[model samples]
Target: MSNEKRPYKGGHGKPGHAGKPGNGKFSQGNSNQGSGQGEGGAKRKRRRRSGSGAGVNEQNRQQSQNSQRTQNQRSQGRPQKWDDNSRGDKKRFENRGENRNDSRAESRTGRRFDGLTSVERAARRAKTEHDDTKRGGGGTSQRNKSGHERNRRSMSAREFSAAAPSARSRTADTARATVFEVLRSVAESDAYANLVLPKAIRSHRLDHRDAGFATELTYGTLRHQGTYDAILRHCVDRPLEKVGTTTLIVLRMGVHQLLNMRVPAHAALNQSVSLAREKIGAGPASFINAVLRRVSERTPDEWYELIIEDAKDDTERMALLASHPAWIVRSMRQALVAHGRPATEIEQLLEADNLAPVVNLVALPGLGSLDEAREQGAVDGELVEGSALYASGDLARLESVREGTVRAQDAGSQLVARALAAAPLDGTDTAWLDLCAGPGGKAALLGAIGVQRGASLVANEAAPHRAQLVESSMRPLPEDSYTVLTGDGRQIRETLRKNASALPGSIEPGQLFDRVMVDVPCSGLGALRRRPEARWRKSPRDIAELLPLQRQLLDAAIEATRPGGVIAYVTCSPHAAETQNIVAEVLESGAVSLLDSAAALREVALHTEGANGESVSVLAGEKDPGHTPEIKVKKGAPAVKAAENPTTAQLWPHVHGTDAMFLALLRKN
Candidate 1:
């Protein structure tokens, strides 16, 4: 229905201040901002007879046209000359005129119907009338001609545009089961939110900012759905489970706006209400409006207060108000205490789950450095600040990023990986392993570093599907410098040792890798902002379920490192069991010691300035106390002394401006 022509009053640009030197206001309709060009008045009149409509339809159409004409006349009424500004205006208008002719030449489907303006104008007027009836005392009507009719008629192609003054357009609000159909397929079948969203926005021709907004809404709403549905149950007449999925999705979208965002209450409610009418049947539109209005009456803080008020226990308090599952809240609390953090810091941990992860970057060490990028305007961070690569423009689309010289990596991870990579392992040539380097993020940087620094790297990934990531990461590098192995790291170490004597230069003075990276898999709780569904998917016992895997991964990475070599244990979660405890347990074996990763990462520089215009760098990872200081490490013949407790760097949701990642670098004695 967006293609349905609508009328505007006095909207066209004014004439000489006129285009043709007569009635000079710009033509209304979806036409580019310009005065009418062609004089086909006779043809238009001839075609007017064949138009499908009663006299009133013709009248509505004529009135709409007359209104445009009247608006143009009023615009032309202004004095033709307004001093020197007129000459500038004339030149600008002439240039605009040239562009429009060229831009207007290509048209397809809905875009081609600009020629049928009079008909579209009449339909839109009819649709508007129908919309008015539904909004006012007329109550809900399945018959709203504006949205529904527009949507209904939109099934076909027409060269038309719904010229909107608002931020969102008719084209943008386009709803069809098809959108989510493809999206759900991609999400479930392909797990491709990152890939699908970009293509969808680009195909739809959305601008960058709008694309970002849509991405936020979709991911944020999906992530906070547990709490959203809880609130929805209170508002809806039926249990949310009993409602149709479409209605449920619409309600979630509505609730997300009402509860989480700063969208105006009335605007959010009314537009959502209208959408409900169009999306759901008329029966639910009023109910949806009423409930959303009630939800909107309270601010986000007020909504939290209400959620808190309804909670009857500590678990409920955090879960309800913070939009977290109660079990998750409790588990996070246990993890905090285990890390020697105070109970009062619980709110900080929970809040971190809701914020977005800032784009993190790493510059290719030798070619480009973070400090240089920052001096250009990128801001600096506290830890791993030296090697920091500031986001160029949109982290997803900067020219530098596409070129592969830099990448979006978590600052916390960069800190740990660099700490291990740059640590003094006391070996001229070392064999390094990226245990679980699926689709190689860390391995890419590590591989690049290994290549430049006279070291060999073995990037092992258990998952064959993810090996491609490793392959892509090390593309063009000398094949001899690195080996992409699809096998268990534990077994890879066994094989490497068995063939040690057979391999030349492989068995160096102190063989295995001077450093190894274990970017192990986990629930990804620290990355809730990115994987909106993560917090919801994580169970209270996730740490328990994952502890064994994490331990095995760590053990393998440690085993792969040469004596006195470093193992960088990293995860997106700050959970102690998965981070500090994993390192602590391995240390208990007296096989390795902990290193001061914080100090190790300080070796690298960082950038912090905004992307566009003047770019520059800022200090990094300094906010995390654990990141600034080095952890205790064992130094003796291998297994010489009991390993010291490792330093685990946990970045904050705010301070680090990255995912709440955890990193601890451990060294073998």
Candidate 2:
């Protein structure tokens, strides 16, 4: 018997057994001898270890034969090919017969192969054929691995563009996109457009022309949003509120361009639809297109006439035409009569509010000059000195503006700040306070003047974030000239007292300021032109809520002032409750007496000579002789005579081309 492994010979009944030699099988004696020896013994052992039936033995034998055939084919320089037509070949490939579970037998395409699925095999063959074709081999037309025929003919530019309408049609213009984003932010976050627009402009990297366009679009849409909604109610099938926010904003922008801006109707419609499609979805885009198309059917004047017809009275009519809320229109009328202007001026006032205000720049006193701004195409300001009107483009482009010396401020604001600095004080006029200086526009002006006049300013704000803004605004001035404090303006005395050690020069414990600027938070009714969205956001209830804070801040301002020191009680609103009423209540305390605010403003305005080398009167008195009305004091409170010169001054947009800022100068008694 041999020890070497050998192939199994054919047998009749049992493992490792042979039949008779004469019967085409091995002799029985030889088979018995072989079974007890080397190779035969190994086969017997393997069969015993497997513990399987004769079927398993037959599978192993078939696998061994297939392996031998594959090796022989490979040795002949070509692998064995699969035959789809042969059932035997297919069965041989399917039954791996390895006794182990084979995952490759399960094809992803549900069609089995040796290791790859039928689809994968076809793909590989197509890819090989494509490569051969590229190499100039004799192959069929070029096809992708997925078996799709490739289009080899070149297309003209026009044809190519026509082939992809989505790529060309879905994009929105940068200017319109910027405006839409700003409108969304204003609506969603209750943000001011003035605060959000500049950041958006910079982020969008819009050029000066585009920036101007975006600014107009955003402001115009917001200014006339009430009117646009009125028109939309007629155009849209559903309620305005039911419309998606994105779709509504797009519609508003389109309406503004069509009615108010110089944009052509077709361009407005197409751009707006495109913007809606890109930002929202195609469904909303179609809806927007239909609505805007309906709106464009009528001219702006015709639309205005149509909407005004729905008004029930003169107030509602003015509200619709002026794009102001009816309540706001009534308030403006009442405010005009209360403030000594004729009620008829309400129309003019409302019209002014609709007009976009020019960018008014103020060069910080002593630390800044308007010469640089003037050289850059800024004209001299009409209302105040050291100020310029910038209409060329983005003010941030100016070097002086970026340096924070030249600022974008309203002429009315500049007047109030200068009036406070110019108010006659009896005692040492060294210390000043901005009780509610959150944004620090007035504080910066006051701080700059204080630095020149040997005074220091303490800018206090209730919000920490706005206090940081105050600090940033005053950074361009001398560090020692101003102190930024984060605390309630009503608790200014305590805040200043606690931080005595850290106070700026000569500001000691219990030492009062010579001038206190209490620009208290108000309804912001006056700045409707600058912040158009504010008109919609404000209500009479808001004014009522602000009255208490206004009174408390004014009282705090009076207490912080030394005897004979003047406090400029200011509000960007001319509303009677926030202005005259608040001042009258504070005057009743006998802790302070009203000074001639109109005189102070006149003095500040006239302090700078006009281009003709003579004084120009920018006060409302010059235009409306009865601009000053008698102060409304309580029954027992001391009365201010109407015959006396106007003590408080209200700047009107219609009369002065400025925000309707109200000022009441009070001297501590």
lDDT of 2 by residue, 1-669 (tens): 334223345432224534432244453332234333456567765674475635655655665566567679889999676554444644645564531224444534443445676699878886676565445352234465678664322222211212212423578899999998999999888999999999999999999899999999999999999999999998975578666676788999999999888999889988988887677654466667889999989999899888888689999999988989888899888888877778999999999999989999999988788888888889998878898898887777888888999999999999999989998777698898999998989999999998888899999999999999898899998887788998998888889888887789767777888999999898899999999999989888998898888888888888888877888988999888888777777765556677778888887884445689976565534543124444444566544433246477888999989999998888777
Q: Give the top-scoring candidate (lDDT).
A: 2
Off by over 4 Å in 2: 1-169, 607-616, 624-646
The global C-alpha lDDT for each of the candidates, from Candidate 1 onward, is 0.60, 0.80
lDDT of 1 by residue, 565-653 (tens): 77788888877668776776676666776666554544553545655854333433335335322233345434345334335566656
Off by over 4 Å in 1: 1-196, 266-290, 367-382, 386-396, 476-479, 494-511, 601-624, 627-639, 642-646
The local lDDT score (0 to 100) that residue 619 gets in candidate 2 is 55
Clash count for candidate 1 is 60
Model 1 C-alpha lDDT versus the unseen true structure: 0.60
